[model samples]
Target: MLTLFHSPGACSMGIVFLLEELGVDYTLAAIDLRKGEQNDTAFRQMNPKGKVPTLILDDGTALTEFPAIAYWLCRRHGAAELWPDTIDGQARVLELVEFLVASIHMRGFTFLAMPQKFSADPAAQDSLRALGRREVEAGLATVAAQHGAALCARSRIGIEDAALFYILVWARALGIAVPAPLSAYAEALLARPSAQVALRGLAAG
Candidate 1:
């Protein structure tokens, strides 16, 4: 059985939603980020990156990273609706995924959430946070311009939107305003049975 290491309300929640949508059997292992369970020796043994959303396959093979996990699940389960079929559509999915995970989550949100990683100086930290806010808003605007209308009010949830959902959660936490289109998208996503199950988390087996 697949085992997913995740923290509630974190980026790993996206993977949780994907797993639910796939309707595949999987186990959930909670990692307390606040308590630093990610850095624990046992968890680190499986994933040296010490991050959430680390998927442990049946054979004990560890898969780390969001995009990789999402792709693997969709392919393994024949979830074409979540992934896409055509070359252009696949390319668009990847483009949005990379932008959302790498740019929005890694760079922008990290900056705002953990500015001390960039610099120890208090003055520099302030500037870093400000830069983070700008980066996130600008990145979100790019998303809104490119695909917001298509995704907003959409009944079918794509892989890209799963990625976008987590970012929207962070945006809300940071008190950042998201585009109207994306806001509607978030509502639709959250209302789904998959999302509802994901939010409450799955039972460990």
Candidate 2:
């Protein structure tokens, strides 16, 4: 069985949705970030970075980071519907994934939610967060411009959409305002059955 260590409403929510969409058997382990369970010694051993969404494979190997876990699940279960097929399709998926991870996902969460790590000076931290917010907005705009419409019309969920959906959710939870297009995109994603299950689970937790 696969075990996913996740926090409510974190980017890990996307992983949860993906698992359900693929109809794969897995176990969900909630990490209470509010109580700093992510920083606990046992959790640190699972993810030294103290991040959520760590995947423990059936063989007891742990996987950190979203892109790897998402892709691995898609491949392992032969769920090609959640992943692209051709070379160009795969490249586009990766391009979107990297942009979200670098500009919006990591940068957004770090500067906004954990500013103390970047700087001790209050003014400096605010300045960095302001810049990070702008970058996140720009990154979302770029994603919407490039692929939003195509994804909305697609018949099935794919890795790019899953990644983008979770990033938007995390942004909202951190009180980062997203533009209208991205908000619409998120609404569409959340309306899916798999996402509904993930949302209910998050709410219940």
Candidate 3:
């Protein structure tokens, strides 16, 4: 069986949602980031980067990074609905995934949540967090303006939606204001059965 290494409330939750949506059987391994479990030797052996959402395949190979894992699952499990069918559609999904992960999650939330990593001075840490907040807001605004309408019209959950939902959770935690339409979009995603199952799975893990 496949095993997914994840941290509660992390971007790995997005991968959990994808796995649940695909109806795949997988085991969950919770990594406690708060206690510095990610820095442990055992975890580092699995993923040198020491990141969550690491997938250990049945063949004993490890796969890290959310987008790559999502794509691998979709292709291996024949879940084409999770992604687009056409070239342009596929490109758009990839684009959104990259933006959400890199620009929003990495540049914004990661910085905001762990500003001390960026600087040694106390005042500098606060400044870094403030900058992260602005980046998050700008990134969210871009998402809302570009994809809010399309997301509202989606009848089935897609990979991009899973990624976006994770970001929305971070946005809420950071007290970033979401536009009304995107907030509704997020609500719709949360209401999905797959999403519900993912939440329960995360809680259990």
Candidate 4:
């Protein structure tokens, strides 16, 4: 009885993977970002920020933002192991997820994808993209130090892996070179059955 407002090929796929991991039934509502449907009145009523991965719970408590939604889902479905057992482990996962989402994706990739959002001048946009590359590469080095790719396991894919997965997707699309360990880790996660099904559902939607 949950509903997810998502955009295909967007970071919302991370939430889709979480839903698949939880093995929970939920509605997938497609919002075409190219068409600017997210800014439409109906969706704005749900989430004024007009972002994807908007989750409407059964009781109609709409949730927005990746970290918050992912955390709530993992906690609500504790058996998934998306959440760690100990407080330190949980804190570690939260820290990694926060960095990947807040710093890497929002600050880094967003600039790479839409540099003009930061500035109108072409030269400034190019400079902004260069800065974005530095931010992303630096973040990847931090992730590599943590063995982030290994966060995905045969039994369960931790929320950190899901968070890392989206940024890796953007990196590849933008032609940024991913370090060997994280690249291999992402390929393995893609081979996961849950990821396969989640991707298929998003593509179909």
Candidate 5:
């Protein structure tokens, strides 16, 4: 069986949602980020980057990173809908996922939540946070314009939806305002049984 290493309320929850949606039996290993468990030797042996959402395959090979893990699971399970078969459709999903990782999580949330990582000076940290706020707002707008309406209209949830839902969790925690459409879309996703199951996993952790 596969084992997924995750932290509560982290972006790793996206993988949990995907696993629930796929109906795959897997073990959940909760890493307590608050206590710095992710930085420990055991965890580092599995993922040198010391990040959550690390998947240990049945053969014991470890996989890290959201985009790669999501794609791997979708393909391994033959869930084509989650990751379209066609080049163009697959590209679109990847584009959205990468944008969320790069523009939103890396450039926006990381700076906003942990500005000290970027600079030591207090003034620079404040400026970085302000910039993160702007980037987050702009990123949400882009997501709203690109995928919000389509995601809400679709009956089946996809990989991109899982990723977007996770990002919204961070947005809410940071008190960042999302676009109106995305706000509604978030409600829709949360109502799904799969999303609820994933949330329960996080809460239980």
Candidate 6:
């Protein structure tokens, strides 16, 4: 069985949702990031980066990063619809996933977690946040344009879509504004049974 060290509503929830979607049995170890549990030495040993959503493999090793973790889980469970069987297909999914990670996720972390690094002056900080908003809006627009097309249904919730969903959820939790198309796509995805279960599980915990 796999063990997931996750913080509720964090990017780790994406993996939880995927596990639920795949019907894979696993253990959930909640790490309360708000209380600094993630910084504990034991947790740091699991993920040197001190991040939530560290996945412990059956062999007792750990896996980090959204795209890589999702890829491994999908392949391990033989869930082709959520991963893809062919090399080209997997490559395309990974390509889009990387785009989300490099562009959207990075910007989110910078704005939300490291606001001080962007600017010292209050006005400058506000300016940076506004810029971050525009960046997030543009990124989500791109995601909607790229993933909301009819072609997306052919692939289902593959790696790109999964990562895209994770970013959208994270942004919303932080009160970041989102455009209609992206919001709609996220809402539709969240309406799925697996997603609801993952969310409710987090709420319950």
Q: How far in Å is the alpha carbon of 108 misplaced in model 3?
A: 0.5
lDDT, candidate 4, residue 27?
A: 93
For candidate 5, lDDT tens digit of each residue in 1-205? 9999988788888898888888888999999888999999999998999998899999999999998988888878745566677999989989999999878998998888889987999999999999999999999999998888887788776777668878987787677888978889987777778777677645331
> In candidate 5, how many Å is residue 152 off?
1.7
Pull out the clashing pairs in model 6: none
State the TM-score for model 3. 0.92
Residue 181, model 3, lDDT: 76
Off by over 4 Å in 1: 201-205
What is the Å distance of residue 179 in model 6 from its true position? 4.6
Model 1 scores a TM of: 0.91
Q: Which 10-residue window in model 2 sums to the lowest lDDT?
A: 196-205
Error of 1 at 162 (Å): 2.1
After superposing candidate 3 on the true structure, give the runs of residues whose Cα lies further than 4 Å from its correct spot: 200-205
Which candidate should be chosen as best, given lDDT against the real structure? 5
Error of 3 at 142 (Å): 0.6
Candidate 4 per-residue lDDT over residues 1-205, each given as its tens digit: 9999988778998888888877878999999998999999999999999999999998897999999988888888647456678999888888889999999998888887889878999999999898889999988888876764454433566677667767776676677887767777777777777777556534331
Off by over 4 Å in 2: 174-181, 201-205
Q: Model 2 over residues 1-205: C-alpha lDDT tens digits? A: 9999988787888888888888889998999888989999998987898987899998887899888888888878746566667889888888888888876777766676667778999999888788777777777778778777776667777766568768877766667666666677788787788877676555431
Q: Relative to the unseen true structure, what is the C-alpha lDDT of residue 87 in candidate 3, on a scale of 0 to 100?
A: 96
How many clashing pairs does model 3 include?
Answer: 0
TM-score for each candidate, following the candidate numbering: 0.91, 0.88, 0.92, 0.90, 0.93, 0.84
Alpha-carbon local distance difference test for all models = 0.84, 0.79, 0.84, 0.81, 0.85, 0.74
Q: Of the candidates numbered 2 and 4, which has the greater lDDT value? A: 4
